[model samples]
Target: MRQLLQDLFDKRVNQFVSDKRSKKLFFPKAETKQACLANRSAEIVKVKAAGKIIEESVEDEFQTIKYQAHYQYLIKQNGILYMEEEMEDRLAKFYKNALVMDEEIRPILESENDPETELNHLDLEDHTERLSYAYDRLKAVQYAERWWNSYNPAYKKFQNDCTNFISQCLKAGGAPMRGYPKRDAGWWLQSNNWSYSWAVAHSLRLYLSNSKIGLRAKEVSSPDLLKLGDVICYDFEGDGRFNHNTLVTGKDANGMPLVNAHTYNSRMRYWAYEDSSAYTPNIKYKFYSIIDE
Candidate 1:
């Protein structure tokens, strides 16, 4: 069944990606098109001259072949969760390649420009809770290890483990899991089942963004503002589709946050992931400063 689901997911995602890539030739912004051509004029001319091909066709062919190879490589390395990362890698690669045009790539990084969805926010910013509350970083770190190493031995394991791992860390730092049994409700982990926010990355993003009472978060503008016990959610595409989560465990001397996560079983990994196929030029991130009581 697991194999079946994985195969189905791969098929659906490959089609979805192919569809998105087919629409990649348009430049969403005039400035983006000019800047890209100015930077890679030589390659653009070469591709245009090579087969007397239309610029968009040359760019399209390059992107399609490059992206397919990248996806295959990701599956070879990270077999389990390569779908989101594959698109991310392809996005970053698209911008760096000279064979592609600015308009062809910038649309992927383009935003909807809607204020409500794009704004960074702090819940209960003027609340009286700030003075009296503090996160137990020690407990949070300790609990992170328990989840990583299964020291607790009781919390249920998950197929999609990233969000589950982050939730355990939050509970350690004192985030209350108010809803139980109701999957659509707010974050909670029952014995064998859990809330959507406890196990799904997109759902958790919404839960924290809209949270009003039990546990809320302040969305920091950058990962550099995040400290130990803070949370970072990943949207592989520049669009609002979040697919992964990690907990901050430590920082480098350069003040870069080192993260710990489950699904891939990483410990103290660098927070800015540029090498993975899961990174995109339009890669959007949510850095959450958890409020603990």
Candidate 2:
């Protein structure tokens, strides 16, 4: 199934690149196009282009695919059923806590646009106080390994581990999960089981669409345009379906963007473009930033 998914993804990407509509409408800007052409020409001249090396370096930083196959196989064999269940349950708890955190930070988000009003409300030296509040709220919700161990062994293994962590981050940042069906425990709880990808994706969509959070989606070309709390969506293999999602943490020493993601193969890890090993061709990526200001 994994191989099939990869092949299908690759085929879709190849078709997309080969399509005339995509070539004309979706190509990078003149500057980026020129750079791509120049790099290709340089590769032809010396059979070794420095830019190609750099691209390879960027792709290599992500090592997700190496372990994805193993996990996929385990899932297929039902060997990790218990672990997956544990993860789902733990994720549910995490989501519950995230809901609470969002409530606690409501004042901060409400005052995000007005620095003077925010400063007046809190006794602080500068923006550091608010920033520290945000950071501490985020840190307090992060459950380490011990929290994971508290779950049943079976429920811990095969879940969408990265999305679970990211959900907490989103809540810390004041994005509450809304519009979910009511359950005995919470308002956002759903009776149906959702894929990890779906849970995170829908949660984000809900938050952005809600008037309270006020995150407006935007079109972005390069990772450089992304901010610390921005969201990146990937159409792995160039198909219309956006399958992967990540958060932009910051930039690396070489100025490449670093991402936090829980991918099928990579689990949870920091990734960058310089690592070619991480690049899966035919993926059309889109970015969106939360509108705090």
| lDDT computed for candidate 2 | 0.33
| Residues 1-293, model 2: lDDT tens digits | 23432442343233323433353422122223233323323111111101001111113222112111111001111121111111100000112112111000011111111112211111111222222112222331232212322332322222434444444445456553433342111113233432222234423333333323222346566777766756666555464544445665544333334455542322212333222222456757666665554
Task: State each model's CA lDDT, in order.
Answer: 0.54, 0.33
List model 1 lDDT by residue over 1-293, tens digit each.
22322332344334422322244423232123223323423111110100111222124425322111112211111122121111111121232233232211211211121122432332222333323345687788878856653435667766566777888888888776665566666568877777667777777787777776676788989888887888888887777768788888876545667677765555655576544345779888889887666
- Model 1 bad stretches (over 4 Å): 1-134, 149-152
TM-score for each candidate, following the candidate numbering: 0.54, 0.39
Clash totals for all models, in order?
5, 30
Model 2, residue 216: C-alpha shift (Å) = 4.6
Q: What is the lDDT of residue 268 in candidate 2?
A: 18
TM-score between candidate 1 and the true structure: 0.54
